[model samples]
Target: MIKNIMQKVMALACSFIFSTGLAFASTQTAVTAQLVKSEADGTVLICQYRTMKKIHFKVLFTHQVCPLAIQVGH
Candidate 1:
């Protein structure tokens, strides 16, 4: 029937669109922004260490919040 053919055509078109979108998305590259160090830091080593510690603390806090948030969420 005409309806059946149209349904198949629409489904094929949707699949093609989704496939192309995913392909384009995967081809995109990730961009990372580096932070600029201030003069007070004195050296690059100290600046890197400070940034590492801050990142560590943030990750720890985020992990710790997950459990408490899950309990409250439920």
Candidate 2:
């Protein structure tokens, strides 16, 4: 009886840990991008992200029309 209870508890704990880790991982990589400008050349996107280092990530849509507006994080 005690062994079974312990096993159940451990399983629960492990699952909780895994779920939390996945959630954290997803949040860390998630970012929001805004259409800054659009020209005949291409469209520019300003991305917002949270991280330790400052990285300059630019998006340009040369052939496609600039995105009107977007609200997404992934």
Candidate 3:
């Protein structure tokens, strides 16, 4: 029936809206980590960071070259 079809359409629309909101919300808390491994021995390394929002870097050393921790939007 037409009512049943309309109900299904409304449900689909609500689900889509809810999912899009979740996707945007997730991006706010999302963080990306990067690892840099140096093949040549060096004491100091040059690094550049790029992001949509403000970020801070926490450098962790496991070896000569280690992973970089990135914090977004804070």
Candidate 4:
């Protein structure tokens, strides 16, 4: 009975550690994109970039779109 309890406690501790590690690993990041145009009616848009995530350093690249910037926190 004591051994079983100890095993269960160890398992719980390991699980908690693993979960915390994952939670901390997946941090957060801010991404932004802008359109450089010359004309008003219709213009050519250029230059697009996404900021790297703080923890994972993940970046998503795309062209001109509705969501020019996005911020995700884990």
Question: Which structure among the candidates has the greatest lDDT?
Answer: 2
Off by over 4 Å in 4: 26-74
Best by TM-score: 2
Query: In order, how many clashes per candidate?
Result: 0, 0, 0, 0
Off by more than 4 A, model 1 = 26-74
- Root-mean-square deviation (CA) per prediction: 13.8, 7.9, 5.7, 9.6
lDDT by residue for model 3 (1-74), tens: 99999999999999999999876774347655443332333545433344545433444333544345444452
- Worst lDDT run of 10 residues, candidate 2, spans 47-56
By TM-score, is 2 or 3 better?
A: 2
The CA lDDT at 11 in model 3 is: 100
TM-scores for candidates 1 onward, in order: 0.35, 0.36, 0.36, 0.36
Pairs that collide in candidate 2 are none
Model 1, total clashes: 0
Assess each prediction's global lDDT (C-alpha) against the native: 0.38, 0.56, 0.54, 0.47
**lDDT score of residue 7 within candidate 3:** 100
Give a tens-digit lDDT track for model 4, residues 2-74.
9999999999999999999765663353234332222222343333333442322222233333334445443
What is the TM-score (0 to 1) of candidate 4?
0.36
